[model samples]
Structure formats: C-alpha cells, structure tokens
Target: MEYYEGSFDSIVGDLVAGNRVPAVISDEEYGWIISISYPYKSESGELLGYVCADISMDSVVRDRQNYLLSTLLILAGVTAVFAVLYYVLFNYVFVRPIKRMSGAAAEFVSGGRDGEFSSSIATLSVRSRDELRLLCDSLKRMELNIREYVNNLREVTAEKERIGAELDVARHIQSSMLPCIFPAFPERREFDIYATMTPAKEVGGDFYDFFMVDERHLAIVMADVSGKGVPAALFMVIGKTLIKDHTTPGRDLGEVFGEVNRLLCESNSEGLFITAFEGVLDLGTGEFRFVNAGHEMPFIGRKNTFRAEKIRPGFVLAGMEEMRYRAGVLQLNEGDKLFEYTDGVTEATDAGNGLYGMERLERVLCAHGADTPQEICEAVKRDIDAFVKDAPQFDDITMLCLEFRQKTPGIKEEEQ
Candidate 1:
C-alpha cells in the first residue's frame, strides 16, 4: 500500500510542478522518448495535478520514409524519358550520316572505281550551316579532282620518259665521236700517248685527239668550247674537224691554227669560242712546234724534272674573223715528255668547290715523272678520283701526254 501510494504521488507531483511535463524514456536498440504535460487546478484557482498523455514518434518516422521513396520514383521516371529521347535524336542526327561518309571515303582511297559509292545510304537531311556539312561537300569534290589529277600526272610522266630515252641515245653518240681506244698508233715505237674525257653531263664541249700527219710528224690537239651540252658538242665537232684538216706534214703549227680560227669565225653562231692547243712533233728530230689560242700553259718533263713552258697567247678561236696565231718551238730530248689538256682537266671541282688547279696537276706530274705517258695519265686520273671521291664531276675532264724516245741506230725504217 505504501509503495503504490508513493508511485502515484511521484506521478502526481511531476504533473503539478509549474510548467513541468512527464516523460517516459525507453532504451530500445535505437532508444525512444515519449513526453506529456497536464494542467493542474486547486480551490480558488490554486494549481493541482490533473491528467497527462504521451506517445512515441515511430508512426511519423514511417510517413517521412514513404515521402522520400515517392520523390525518388518521380526523378527516375523523368531520367528515363530524357534518355530515350537523347538516344533516338543522336542516332538520327549524327551517327548514321557520319558512318556512311566514312565508308565512302575509305572505298575511294582504296582505288574504288568511279560511281562505285554505295547508293543505299541516304543523304543526311539534318542540315545545319555548320562545319560537318561543309566537310562532306569538300570530300566529294576532292574525290573527283583527285581522279582527274592522277590521270594528267600519268601522261606527263610518260612524255618525260620518252624525252629522257632520246637524250640517252644522244649521249651515246657523242661518246662514240671521241677516240676511246688508247695507245693510238702503238706500232710507232718513237713515243707512247694516252687520253681520256669525262663529261659533266650527257655531252660536253671538251675534246682531245692525236694522229700522225706523216711518218715524221704527229699532230696533237686539245680544246674546250665556251659552253656545255648539245650546242657545245656540235661546235666541238666543227672545231675538231677544222683543226685536223689544216694540220698536215710540213705545215706550220701557227698557220694551221690561224686558218682554223678564220674558218670557225666565218660560220660562228651562238657566239661560241674555243680555247685550244695544237702541236706538231718531228719524231726524227724530237722538235715540238705548238700554238696556243688562249689555252693554259703546257708542262714539259725531262729526266724526272717538270716545268711549265711560257707560250705567247692568241685570241680564242671564233672570236674574231682575222685572228692570227704564232708558233712556239721547244726541243725535246730523248726521254722528254709533254702534257697538254683542256682547262676542264685542271678545273675539275670537289664538293668543297676547290679546283684541281695547275699546282695540283704539276705536283701529280712531278710525282710520277718516271712513269710512261700511259702511266702518267692513269696516275693523274687516280689522284683526281681520290681527291674528289663521291663528288660529281662538274666539268669535262680531258688530258693528253706524249713521250719522245730516241731511235736506235740500227733500227730499220718502215714506209708510211
């Protein structure tokens, strides 16, 4: 009875307290609280404990959860609608047309024939004034232009090949005009001679020749025309012919050059000129009579010593109508050698633009002074080839060497 009264009293006291509320706190796994308040009344308006009520918040929490779920469902439905529209619009507006054009371009590059583009693919109708449309138009035009351009290119290439073949034939003919067989007139034991020419291109203006005017006289000639290629080659042919025609046994070297110069000047076209050296050797006497027309000085070698011979200069042939050349005479002893060449031989260039000049040529001759004419020529060629290894020969390289030997006392003479 006391315990029940105490509990009731405590409840009534809490309710009576001014502005106080009764609360039940329960410990569950998460915990919970329930609170209630009641007004109290007494006699003459004095306060007294009355009644109270309380409830837990579990039902309100469940309603809030239901509201959140509804909101999520609405958002997911909206997203699905947007996704379906986006995929359909994207496929229609972008993907299909691009795939078609890509296929067409691939086919075109892989040697597809004209009008072979797939016709089943429809032209894109989603036209906007943007870069993609312009790109497609440009591609189509480029395809057409490429086909025409390639056809034109083939024709041009074929024409070029034809012209190249003709030029090769011309080059061969020009080479044949030169005397390639060495040691010409080898049976004449008095001297040995050798010459060579390497043109800068298919044909060149430099030339050399040696032939006997008679049993006692040998005519040697070397010349360079003013230019290169076919025009110069033609001039070279004319100049070579005139020089050989005028040089004969018992004829003066100066007169031979003078006559040739006048003849060249009369028919000179294209303003061509030639630097030349012509010599007539008396095999029996070892006497050399030579004329120079603006040519480089010749080197004379005897007994392993070589030196340049100073000769009077005359005007280059074909420059003037009445040019006269004077002859210079030098006595060559037995075992003496003479070297003559066009400027091209000394002017051959390396990649560094250095000239194979007179100094180097002289050094070459001096170094190989004891070698025969054939050997000397070979030595010079080898040195130049080494000096300008892998470099293009920039000019016509030509050289001639003549060696005099004394006739034996008992040797029988052969009739010419």
Candidate 2:
C-alpha cells in the first residue's frame, strides 16, 4: 500500500534544486491522481527528504474554483471602502465650503446694509485647517469692512446736510441786510440808481446801498469786509449800522468815516478790516463829495466816454485807530454816470487766468451809450460774462451806479 518506492529518485532530484515536483500517477485504488512533492529544509536551509501528497483529479478542480471566488469578493470589498473615503474628502475639502460661502453671500446681498442677518457670515463652520478655513476668515473680514464703510458714509452725508441748512439761513439773512430792491430810490426824478451784489460760492461780505440823507443829498455806500462766511456777515452788520448812524445833516463826510473807524477798531477782536467808498451827491448843484477807505477807484462816464477818476485812497477802516480821511469833490453835469465797485469786480478771473481789469470795464461802460443806471449795469454784466465764460466764480462782485440828470429847477430851497 505504500506508494513512494517508484518515484523516490526523481523526488530526491527535485529536493536538491529546492523546488516542487508535480507528477501524474495511476493507482488501482485511487483511479488517476496527482502527486506533488515539496522539499523540506532545516533551520540552516540544508535540504532534507521531500514530502509528497496525492489528490484526486476531481477534488483538485473544485478547490481551484473556490479560491477564484474568494479572491474576487475580497477585492470588491476593498474598492468599495476606498470609494466612500474619496467622497468624504471631496465634500469636506471643496464642495461644503463653497456651498456655505455661496449661501452666506446671497443672504448678505438680499438683506439691507444694516440687516441683522449679516452675522451669519461669521457663523460658517468650514474649519478644515486648509484653504476652506482661510476663505471663511476672508469673507468674514470683508463683511465687517463693508458694514463699517456704510456707517461712515452715512455719518458724512448727515453732517453735510446739517451744515448746508445753516448756510442757507445765513445767506438769506445777509441778502436781507443789503438794498436788493430794483429801481432803488424810487420817486426821485433827479437821478436814476441801481446796484447789485453777487456772493461767492462761499458766503462773502460785500454790500451796496443808496439812500436819501435829506431831500436833496443822496448817500451811496459800497464796501467789502475781510474774510468770508458767518464771521464776515456779522462784521458787515456792524459796519453798515455804524456808517448810517454817523451820516447826519450837518456831519462832514470825512469826519463821519473817522468816527466810524474809531468805533470799529475798538470792537474788531478778529483784526478784521473793511475797504469802502461813501459819497454824497447834491441834487441841486450836482456836486459829488466822496471819501475812499483804501477801496477801488470809481468810474465816471460822460457823453458815451468812461474814465477812472484821480482820487486819493485812505487807510482801511478798523485797521487803525484815529485814522484821518479826506473828502474829494467832483462836479457831475447832466447825464453823467458815476460807477463804484469792490475789488471783486476788477479781480474777476476767467478760465484763462486773465483778470477783468479797468480797461475792460471802461470799454463796457462806453459801449452802453449812456443807458439808464439799470440798463448800464446789465450791459456791463453781460460783457463780463462774455469775457469770463464758464469760469468758476472766485469772489463776490459788488457794483453801484448812479446817473445825474439836469439840476432841479428853482430848487435853491431844497439845497438847505
């Protein structure tokens, strides 16, 4: 029954090579079998005798099929595990953070700038310790910055509106202080008078007025105060009041200015000063007596010709105490025009940086051909516009004009 005797030599050959030998044998009891012989080695790898085992042909085929099935099942299980892990990584690292940021941005936009729902921007949980976390931090910071900017803009707009309202009120009060009514000195047949004051974009202190001191003498004033805005306006009120009060029936022109100057210097805490021209015209004899306080020269027009007068200028009022002013006299015949203005008129600038000086003013006056005071003023203003078109107004322009008609007939009594 022992079957190892026939294959002993070949088994030894296989063992020497340290390999397995497989052989087919026919046995009467087993009916066709396969024999496998393997070498046995000691701990030092020294080969010993071979060991042989026999299996029936049918059983060998069955074992091979079972092994194939088990291998396929194990491989499928491992692939499924990897697929789940890949999905988790993609969702956490890329998809989830993007979705959360998109949602947050949408909500922030749909809500108003001051909406309380903006806090959701900071509540996102994209803490992957990677780009997702960095993106979250940046989004939160941007939201905070936007909100802060909105708040600051609101504050600035409100402050601007408040200041604008106050300026509007101030502008109204300043306009009221001047003589704005057209055809000033109505019901006076001896002369025709008109005056205008245009303020700068910022409020300015320039004023003009003409009033009858008595039945025959007309007082005319043109003045400009230092600086601008509310302070200049308040100072203008004081100056205007002082000038009117000191011009009485018996008061001299220079002496009136002298007293006003003293009073102004005492109250000028801001060191402000005024350049002014005050003149009184006698209706009967056509004598014009005037005093200038460092102001611009007046223009006289006769028979369609205009010329600047050669009169001396004195120190500005409120500049020094006890400043003395002198009166100058000029004779204005019938149909003669006297024009006075602040520096703003001559200093008007165009976009080309050119000044509207005395030459242009004289040309404009002559071009008018001896119009009424109102028409002359309008005509000159048109010329100035043509010269300085589209230029930003740099200063306040004030102009006063008066035309002398024939002397009052049989008015020897009105002169008193």
Q: What is the C-alpha lDDT profile of model 1 across 8-97, one tens digit per residue?
A: 234655554654554544334433434455567767766775556546657666777888988888898898898999998887667766
lDDT of 2 by residue, 142-181 (tens): 8889788877877898998898888888888888878888
Kindly report which residue stretches of model 1 are placed more than 4 angstroms away from their true locations once superposed.
1-129, 140-152, 407-416
Give the distance in Å from residue 294's predicted Cα in candidate 2 to where it truly belongs: 1.1
What are the lDDT scores of the predictions, listed in order?
0.79, 0.84
For model 2, what is the C-alpha lDDT against the true structure? 0.84
TM accuracy, model 2: 0.72
Question: Following a full C-alpha superposition, what root-mean-square deviation does model 2 have from the true structure?
Answer: 9.9
By summed lDDT, the worst window of 10 consecutive residues in model 1 runs over 1-10
Q: Pick the candidate with the highest lDDT.
A: 2
Say which candidate scores most in TM-score: 1
